[model samples]
Target: MMVGRDVQFAVDKKPCEVGKPILEVEDLVVPSKVHKNNAVRGVSFNVRAGEIVCVAGIDGNGQSELIYGITGLEKPTSGTIRLEGRDITNAPIRERSKAGMSHIPEDRHKHGLVLDYTLADNMVLQRYWQPEFQNHGFIKKNAVLQYAERLIKQYDVRSGQGPATIARSMSGGNQQKAIIAREVDKDPQLLVAVQPTRGLDVGAIEYIHKQIVAERDKGRAVLLVSLELDEVMNLSDRILVIYEGEIVGEFDPKKTTVEELGLYMAGAKKQGEAKA
Candidate 1:
């Protein structure tokens, strides 16, 4: 179990003029080895700096595949992924990370953390090779511990052994918190958080939500992929509803009702087509 103080922060509602696009996915298509058809088809969207654009849909609607493609875990059958106006469709995973992209993967155990590694080591998984954390191929263990301690304290990640704890021994909520701390601390230009608050307690949820909003306030573009209706409604400035691997509707969360959004998610409605 995780314990944290109640966090109350108002989401900024004032309309923000989105600046240059930080991420652009054009005509993205992902083929499935297990399925006959593509997992994602012709999906396109732009995430601008200082805005949070959410892709909302039910589970199994290509959200995971889309994230994999963007993060370079899986190759897209056809598409172009551009970061800050540079085409990075075929860039390697490390190349994308160095180009200012951070990901909080959906499956924490599978993709987010290396359970066997100490918390301090996992904290710098993406940056451990950098000059600050290494010297001529040797990892600066003290530097890693200091950085992990700061994040653990700041993010309220409690563990029996502190920074030395193996991540698998920590509670689920703390593990998620650790992932958030590590990814957010990177201060990436585009933060791709998929199902970030899933299966966590309310307190953890609140903390993570605030951190994501804080990122947008810092002029970072956020691409949120969540199936939770409440999270989609409360956190997103704009919502894109994906159904059967295609985006069928777009709405402003402030003006759309859950019932209407549900219609889109259920494939009962489309943005420009007549409702059945």
Candidate 2:
């Protein structure tokens, strides 16, 4: 949200600092098949710059579709996806990336990393075709290596062979950190941080959370989609619950009770009072 005057609640009492939303999703619908029924229907919300919006659902309730639709991995059947008031409803993945969007997928190994490539190569995976990493049609080895050194050092990515280490060789936590480092280093306007601390131990989870909030403090919008209820309650400024392909509830972390949210997450009942 961008207009400072639009913030209606006091920060001392509210979870969010209101403004014109950095990310506005309206009537967002995603159907699984070309002619199939909707996987996500009428899902909409606003993620203000410097805000962390979490979608907390158990699983199989269109959480994946919500993320995919927003990131251009899947096109919305009907919706307007806006960033900074610009309608980007039909933009391709690359176009979305250039416009400042980053997704840390739920399946990090499958959708995030290139196992065969070295950490350095994979760090620039999404942007390998760009001029900074390319000379003519070849990769600029020095530039990539330099950038990799900076990120690996900055993110504290530990691997047996350091920055030049192969992706498959590093531990899972380190590998995840590499992907995070690469994307976060880009200073994206909106970050789709899907389970940022999924498989990590307590220490790694703490580190990742700090990194996430740090990004928010720098005025970037973060959409955190996670099944871990504790993480959802802890990191999000606002939490949204998706049930049966629709958003059932929205709550401010400071005022809402997670125990009440647990009922909605378990699909026991719909929460109709809180609307995004």
Best by TM-score: 1
RMSD of 1: 2.0
- Native-vs-model 2 lDDT? 0.83
TM-score of each: 0.95, 0.89
| 155-219 per-residue lDDT for model 2 (tens digits) | 99998787678898887788889989988987899999987788886656766787888888788
Clashing residue pairs in candidate 2, if any?
Answer: 1-19, 1-20, 1-21, 1-22, 1-48, 2-19, 2-20, 3-20
Worst 10 residues of 1 by lDDT: 1-10
Q: Which residue ranges in model 2 land beyond 4 Å of their true spot?
A: 1-18, 33-35, 271-276
